[model samples]
Target: MKDTGLVAMTEFLRHPSMVGSAFPATARMVRHMLAPIDWDNVRTAVEYGPGSGRFTFAMLARMRPDARLLAIETGAEFVEKLRASSDDPRLIVAHGSAEDVGRHLTENSLGYADVILSGLPFSTLKQEDAETIMRVTGSALAPSGIFAAYQMRTAVLSLINRQFVDVRQGYEWWNIPPCHLYWASKLRGEGSYEDQIGGSASA
Candidate 1:
């Protein structure tokens, strides 16, 4: 078996835009990102850009036996590695962009996801692509579902707020570059996001 760390670093060096990070997320970072989720009742979850399946495996460990996790990866190497690494029946690895997440869910016979987690670098993505993803992600969740993402920067915060009415932010300082967490839910609203949540985020 290949060292997952080496594989992740290799991919990140080769495709920095797609892979985002040169290292896997730290245990504390993962816990901080997923701590608020109620894994027992989440029947369906979607993960974006699961480069090394680190968070994927963590979610699988906490999720119910019958729950399903749809992993959408743009990197071919990551997709292949994830499929090769997991024998768990609950994992469904899809090689594609997260823009097609809605279709992926429908194709998999899932109505809506209870948990949508992303590790994609939205700051590196095209402006239109990032906007589309945040918009679709909000619509793809179940009413009470949570959408969480962690980034080295807070550039995606405004984009997330544009889609989700209620958004919460957190920070984990132990990671390599440090990690900024955002947990967003509820749908669109008409107020100013900056006015509702006043703060500055920098990393």
Candidate 2:
């Protein structure tokens, strides 16, 4: 397990575009991002760009016994490492792009995810690719589900806000270079922002 950190750094050096950071996410950062998840009702969870399983372990620890986790990683080395080290039957490490999240869910017999966590570096991704991934993430989550991403810049947040109806921001200074986290949920029957604000003003 000790060498896993070194492995993560090496992967990042080789493929900076795929890996989010030079170091694995700190425990504090992982906890902050996962704080809102209702494990009891989370039937399916998806992790995008899970390099070396930093948050994967955290998610597994909090997940229900019957729930399933699909870890979608594009790097072959990371995918191989996850499969080799993980003993949990509920975890399925798939080697694929984050934009293909919907397809992965359907192929695995898992419907839309209850919660989606991302470690992808949107700042490094092409604009079109980032948009596609965010769009797929928005469409792949359940109506009330949340999408949480730990990013270094606000580019990803901007994309997420465009896709999801509600967006919440968080900050974690404990990480290697610190991070800004974004949590977003699609619009359900909840009234629009204008409607809510207008009603409050009238009252």
TM-score of each: 0.90, 0.90
Q: How would you encode candidate 2's per-residue C-alpha lDDT over 40-99 as one tens digit per residue?
A: 788899999898888998899989999999999988878888999889999999999999
lDDT of 1 at 72: 99
Per-model C-alpha RMSD: 5.0, 6.1
Q: Which residue pairs collide, candidate 1?
A: none
- Measured by lDDT, the strongest candidate is 1
Query: Candidate 2: misplaced stretches above 4 Å?
Result: 188-203
lDDT of 1 by residue, 102-201 (tens): 9999999988999899999988888999999988898888987888899988889999878787787778787877988887878443212223222322
Error of 2 at 25 (Å): 1.0
Model 1: CA > 4 A from native: 187-203
lDDT of each candidate versus the true structure: 0.84, 0.83
TM-score for predicted model 2 compared with the true structure: 0.90
